[model samples]
Target chain A: MKNIFTIIKKEFSRFFKDKRMVITVLLPGLLIFAVYSLMGTVFSGMESVDENYKPKAYIVAAPQNLEETFSSILEITEKPSLEEAKKAVTEGELDIVVVFPSDFSQTIGTATPPDVKIFYNSAERNSVYGYTFVTAVLGQINTSAFTVNAASDKFDLATGRDITGNLMSTIMPMLMFALLASGCIAVAPESIAGEKERGTMATMLITPIRRVELALGKIISLTCFALLSGISSFLGVILSLPKLMGGMVGAEAAAFYSVGDYFMVLAIIISVVLVIISAFSVVSAYAKSVKEAGSLISPLMILVIVLGMATMFFAGNVPHVAIYIVPLLGSGLAMSSIMSFSVNPLGFALSIISNLVITAAFVVLLAFMFKSEKIMFKK
Target chain B: MTEILKVENLKKSFNLSRKQQKLEKTYQKVKVAVNDLTFSAYKGEIFGLLGPNGAGKTTTLRMLATLIKPDGGNAFIDGKSIINEENEVRRKIGFLTSELKLEDFFTPNYLFGFFSELYGVDKTTAAQRRQVLFSKFGIDKFAEVKFGNLSTGMKQKVSLVISIVHDPELIIFDEPTNGLDVLTAKVVTDFLEELRAEGKTIILSTHIFSLVEKLCDRVGIIINGQLIALDTLENLTKEKNLEDTFFELYEKTTGDRI
Candidate 1:
């Protein structure tokens, strides 16, 4: 027991002494924080743009009292012809153009209504902005029309906005899986395969300690580092969340996650990290060198990225069995469930069991490798 | 002097498959690494297993060190069977080979501490023994330097230090001075002599006949995995020098056999 502890201590000391290990462990965390923080700043700044700007609108074939109705909200441009207005919209000179057909208000007063063309260039940013402004004015006009027909009911607009915020929170699970895969790939390969390439492995083996003890020590240390990296990545996603949401909606609607949900999401992420680390440790032990290990584990990163994107795009509850058995994907589904406050206790329990079983299998494989002289001394 | 280590009809063979055999064209045959080798080392004697490169010297040492298993036969260290009680045999012997390299990241002092703990030596006793060994071997001066940054001679000395950190009853060294400078080699040879004088059993494998002639109380010559000769230096050197006697024995075994 003392011998094993001594070996573990020696191994850790050797790892901490290397500058490469330090950089490998910390650089990903730092990079994620820096990148996300910068994105957050950009997105937040864009979110702060004022909503009251009366963008210029070109009108052709003006309806009766239409000028009076829109005068308070829109900055009217020159009364151009239909063709000229279309050209203006295309040339970026007009924010939007409203064309009233020949029988505009006459048809509206009767049963037959003429079509009103709201022409805006979808390719231009300013044109989209003008179209959005006009849509808001149109919405208010429709609301007044409804009020004139019947008494208005008390309807909270904030509740509708919060629903959109809930939908966006669904992407959190995929982000967590991405974090786990990235962090594990960076640390696990180097811990075992790198030691072999650097010729430190043989020295480690000749010590009086058993192979299982060494494997456990390495796995525990690497899992801790990987989990730290996962946390940093989760932080990155969190830091960027408000900006991403605020850009799509208002600041009030963007703060979707509660303190409880954040902790639950973090727990799910840690579980995913353990699964990735255990799987990668086995891969690392199988590889003859660090380069080979890196190559072997690279596909895992791609899988995470693809799965994360898929989860983000596809919303709703996952099947119970899949939520438990599918390694990183299971944790991802659980994370999304947590963010949406739709926790399934059965799925969570099964997921923990499955991950623990897989981890134990990896540990057993590593122990077996350590005991095999052929494997340990393979050229 | 009492017998500390004994090898009885020890043999080890590894399977060698020809390219055609690997393709399922023929059956693989066993190639012997150590064949029916037998020798013994008494306490206070420096025993040398002399052989050329590719001889079974390393295989023999590995078996005795319990790092590898012999195919047929057994070895005993301090009356403990290597085949039955490996850990006990390991505890009684300190083994080193030229192929085994030290980790460059650690200082000699740190490595010493690590091995001492591994050998189950008490802290104070380990420290005291470390200090004495470091000074006696003159490795104390550069004990703090990383093994990688040290010169070849210094690294070799550190390797020796870590091997005997627990001060086992019997010490086994495989080509201990292969890569060392003359001065370092002399220091190592002198140190081995001192260990022998202190009534410690020492086993060394070397290709250098002169060193064996000077230091070894008994010598065993192995060729093609078989021990061809085993006797005291004087007995093996009947009427010729050690070098001539080695070649004469080599010719007799390998001449018509190949």
Candidate 2:
């Protein structure tokens, strides 16, 4: 235990005392915040339509009874005939043109109602909105056979919280995995493989300290660093969640999650970080240098990305407990479930337990590798 | 003499990579590095394994240091098996080679404390040992300097100091002065003599004949992983000088012209 603590202290000092490394650990958080917020602002600008602009319409053979309702939505214009109104709309001088048969409003409820011809370009954004607005007004006044979703207080039935939760479950898992894996990549390999390359690791191997102690110490200290890096970026995403998701979700997702939700997510993050760091630590022990370890870890990184995305495809029903026990992917599943307010107690417990077991197995494998001179002393 | 290290049929071999096989100009899949080597060193003595480069001198010492495993047999350090009791063996011996490096990020002072903790040394003894050894090696002058910033000689000295942070009963050095300037070389040779005077058993491997003659109490001459001569310096050098005896043995043992 003392030896493990000693090794951990050494590793911590190696990282914390280096100003450049500390900067690297914190810079991602700041960068994430700035980039995400900028994306939100830019995306929102592109999707919004100007509120001051009204749809222009030329109504021909207008029904006297419905005239009052149509005038409120469209800029009602006078045209002599239906053919002239269609020509004006085709020329793009008018936003929309509508022809109601001579007794259209009166015939709306009859067996064969007069067909209202609305001419609007589907390709034009303004024309699309114009067509929609004009149809809604006609639907209200026509009082025909039936209206689809007309004047029902709120038909969608999804709350702001639901939207926020859906957004979180969809996007957060991938982003979180990517950020945390990157953090592990930045430090874990360099700790073991860098020491091997520099010839410093063998110095410790010669001591009375057990290889298990060395491996544990390295993994734990590296876990702390990875968490710092993962959390900083995570906090950045959380703080910027409102800005980044505002355009799509329409509600602040950040405001919907409670402290308990964050804690649950944090639990998954820690377990995931442990598993990643331990696996990478084993890779580092197997590799001869940091560059080699990085090459080896690249394929594993791709695997992590695929796992992170796995939860999204199987979002609502995470097939089986088998899925929850699959290391990195399991953490993603549990986190998505928690963030979306659909926590499965059994699956969550299984994923975290499986992570710890996998991490322990990796540590033992790392210790075995440490004792192998063939691997450690490979030229 | 009280034997402190015992070697019995210790052997090691390595698989040749294709690139290595190509470089070695051979189709053989394995290279025998150390072969059935046997010897003993006693307390208060410096035993030198003398051989040309690649003659398994370093390999033999590496096995004794528990840095590598022996395929065929085992050795003992203070009666602890290098294979079965590796941790205990490590606790009993201080092994240094050019390959064992101190972290460049840490000061010598910090590394000494870190290694001492690994060795399970008490703080008071560690402090006292540090005071004596650091001053002796002149490491105290720059004890707080990060190893990367230290001069080459200082870095080597710091590595040597840290290797024996617990002051183990046995010391093993592989090519202790392989690439030293003459002045730095003399300092190392003098340190070995000082260690001997303190009654610590030392095992060193070197190809330099003069170094063996100047410092070793007994010498084992190895050629192609086989021990060809084992005797006191006086007995080995009674009729012929050390170099002539080595070449004569080399020609007789391997049937190669010198």
Candidate 3:
């Protein structure tokens, strides 16, 4: 155990003692924050409310009651015929066209709900935005009219909290998983294969310490550093989240998570990092040089990306407990579960256990690789 | 004198690449690095394994160091088997080679302490040993300098100091002075002598006969993965000078005169 600590100390000093290494470890998180914040700013600008630029709408048989509400956000022109309005929309002169039945206002109190038709080119940006604005105004009118006239209690309006929750579950898991993976990839290769490439590993092998101890020391230290980088990048994303989400559908999604939620996130991140470090250590041990290590570990990056993307659909809907035991897949599911605030501790426990087991297996494999002269002393 | 190290028919073989076999125009797949090798070193003596390049000196030393497993036979260090009790064997020996390197990111002082801890040397003893070795090697002057920035001589000195941080009973050096300048080589040779005088057992491998002649109390000449000769300097030099005698042995073994 002391020998393992000694190795850890050496590995840590290898990175922390050098200013350039420290920068490399820290730079990714800061860059993520900066880039995400900038993206949010640009997207927010794109989605800014343009009070002066109203959508040009042509309406037929326009209802006097709802016309005032629609005209507030749209430049309305009464059309005599639906063909003229349809042509205007297709020709791109009109952003949207609304068609109403001749008895639309009178049939509102009837058993049948009147049909309202809206037409716009989906591909045109102006038409899309105009369609969105007109629907929002119409939705408000429908809600008000239904509340006053209808005797139903099943009216469902999604609250900001629900919208934010959906956004958090859908996106946060993928981002967190990707950030953790990138952080581990950044340093694990250099810690193990870099030493081998530099010939320092041979010197280490000649020491009195057990080979397994050396493996443990390296994996532990690498895990610590990788976790640090992963968390830093995660925080970078979290801190800039508001900016990135500005003008997004659920801009207030940041408020959906509590302090306890973040702790769960950290726990999941650390567990996942252990498995990453161990796997990377084996890859590093197999590589002859740092450059080769990088090349060999590139496929693992693609795997991480795939796992991260997998979390998108799995978020808030993780299946069986068995699924949480499949290494990266489980961790991704666990991460999605945590962000969604629907985490089953038992499932997370399974993920943590499975990852730890994988890490241990990989560590043992690394020790065996260290013991193999063919691998350790390969030219 | 008590023998602290022993080798009994130690053997190691490696699979050759298809390209190498084609280049050699041989269908042989396995290249025997060391074959049925047998020798021993005693306490308080410098025993040298002399060999040309690719003659399996490094492989033999590496096996003895327990860095690689032997395919056949076994060796013992201080009565501990290299095969079964590798960690015990490791504790009893200090192995160094030209192929080993210290991390350039670390300073000599830092590495000394680090290795000392790995060897389980207590803090006070490690510090005392560090002071003695550092002063002796002139490493004290640049103790804080990162190893990468140090001169080759300085790096070699630091490596030498660190390799024996535990004061192990037996020390193995593979071409210790292979790439050193004259002054550094002298320092290394002198240090080996000093260790010998302190009653430490030393085994080294080298292709240079002069180094064997000057430092080794007894020398073993390995050629083509086999020990062709082993004798004291006096006995080996009885009939001819060391160089002529080496060539005579080589010619007898390979039917090639050089």
Candidate 4:
């Protein structure tokens, strides 16, 4: 046990003591935050229009009742020629062209009303807005209609907590798995296979500890580093998610999840991380070098990514409890349940237990591989 | 003198991959690395296992170091079986080879402490021993330097000290002077003599004839995975030099010339 601690300390000293390794671990998270925040801001910028600016449109044969609607939200102007207005609208200079028949509002009571053509470029944000306002105003002509959901208040009955839960449930499970898998990939190969590649493993092998102790040491230490890395990345994704959602979600999303829920999520994440790191360690032991280990682990990472995406497709409560014992995919399913506020206690318990059992099996296999001379000494 | 190590019919062979077989231009599927080898060394003298590369000297050291296992037989280090009591055997011996390397990211000072702890050395004794060994190899000045940043000779000195971090009774060093400068080589040769004087058994494996003559009390000559000769340096080289003696035995065994 002391020897295991000794090896753990050595691995930590190797990772945290070096500036390059710290950067390699933390930089991805920092970069993710920076890039995602910038993307959210850029997307908002490209998709929004100024409230004070009204969209300008050309009226070919302007209906007189439409004048009131244009005064508030639309700038309807008379053009010299319809051809010129179409050109301006196509060229993105004009917002839209509402070509109406003369006295079109008077003929609206007829069973077959003449069509009022509202042409606008869907690509332009303001133009799309302008087109919607004009169509609504025309639709109101010659009818005493009750407005459907016309009040300025928010109409959806779902609370802020529901919105947050829905958003997180849709995205968080995939993000968590991918980020944690990345963390495992970043550290496991370097710690295990890099030692083999650089010939440092044999140095540790000559020590008096059983190879199992060394295996335990490496997995535990790497789990710590990978957890650190995963948390950093997870923070980046979580903190930026509100903005990425175009202000649909924010810090309030965290409030929806109770401390118990958070602890459960953390537990699941740890289980997932253990499974990932242990599996990677086994592959790394079989591989001859860090590069070869990476090659060997790529397929597993892909499998993890696919399992993560599975959480996205599994909406609402997972119907069957069997999915909670499928290792990586199971943890992901449990995490999604937590995010969405539908925690199945039995499934959650099963998932965590299943992951831990798999991790132990993987560690045993890794230790056995460590004892193989050909695996350890192969060229 | 009391015997510190014993070997009996130790054998190891490897399955050659198709690519490896093609490279060696041989159709044989298995290549024997260490074959039915046996030898012994006493508690307080230097014994040299002299062989050209691929004659299984390093493989034998690896087996005793518990880095790998022997296929057919077992060895005892101070009566601890290499196969059964591997951890105990590991505690009783120190192994040094090019195949075992210190982490480049670590300074010699850190690696010494790290490996010392792994060897279960007490902190006070480890610190005191570190002081002595570091100063002995002039590693005291470069103790804080990373292993990669150190010169090859300094790296070698640090590796040597790290191998003996627990002050084991038996030290096995393979090709200690194979790539050293004259100064570092002299330091290593001098350290071996010093350890022997302190009553530590040392097994030195090398191909250099002069190194065997200078430091070894007795020598085991190996060729083609078998022990071809065993004698004192004086007995083996009484009439002819060690190299001429090795070639004559090599010719007599497999009828081959280097």
Deviation (Å) of A248 in candidate 2: 7.7
lDDT scores of the candidates, listed in order: 0.73, 0.84, 0.81, 0.84
Task: Judge candidate 4 at residue B23 and give its lDDT.
Answer: 90
lDDT per residue (tens digit) for residues A1-379 in model 1: 5655675587678777887766666666567656654654554212222467776788767755767867777788984476776667665577678766676556654544455557775434456676666666655654323111022321111232333334444556665576667778877887788776665665555555676777777777777778777777666665555454444444453256677766766666666676778778787887889898999888877886676666554354464456556766666666666665566666666666677777778878887876665655555
* Candidate with maximal TM-score: 4
TM-score of 2: 0.83
> Which candidate ranks first by DockQ, i.e. highest?
2
Q: Residues A255-346, candidate 2, lDDT per residue (tens digit)?
A: 67788888888889999999989988988888989999999999887788788988887756876878888887888888998888888888
Once fitted onto the true fold, the runs of candidate 3 whose alpha carbons sit more than 4 angstroms away are A41-160, A247-255, B22-25
Q: Distance (Å) between predicted and true CA of B255, model 3? A: 0.7
In candidate 2, residue B208 scores what lDDT? Answer: 85
Provide the lowest-lDDT 10-residue window in model 2 chain B: B176-185
Comparison by DockQ, 3 against 4, better one: 3
Summarize candidate 1's per-residue lDDT along B1-258 as a digit string, tens digits: 699999999999876657635654547576678999998999999999998876889989988887677889999999999888777887788887766677888899998898888778899999998999899778889999888899989988888888888788899999998888999999999999999988999999999988898899899999989999899988988788888888888889889432
Rank order by DockQ, top first?
2, 3, 4, 1
lDDT of 2: 0.84
Q: What local lDDT does model 4 show for residue B7? A: 90
All candidates: TM-score: 0.76, 0.83, 0.83, 0.84
Residues B1-258 of candidate 3 have per-residue lDDT tens digits of 999989999999988898989876889999999999999899999998987788899999999988889999999999999999988988899988878888888899999999888888999999999999999999999999999999989988999999999999999999899789999999999999999999999998988888988999998999989999999988999989888888899899889867
Q: How big is the positional error of residue B30 in model 4, measured in Å on the Cα after superposition?
A: 1.6
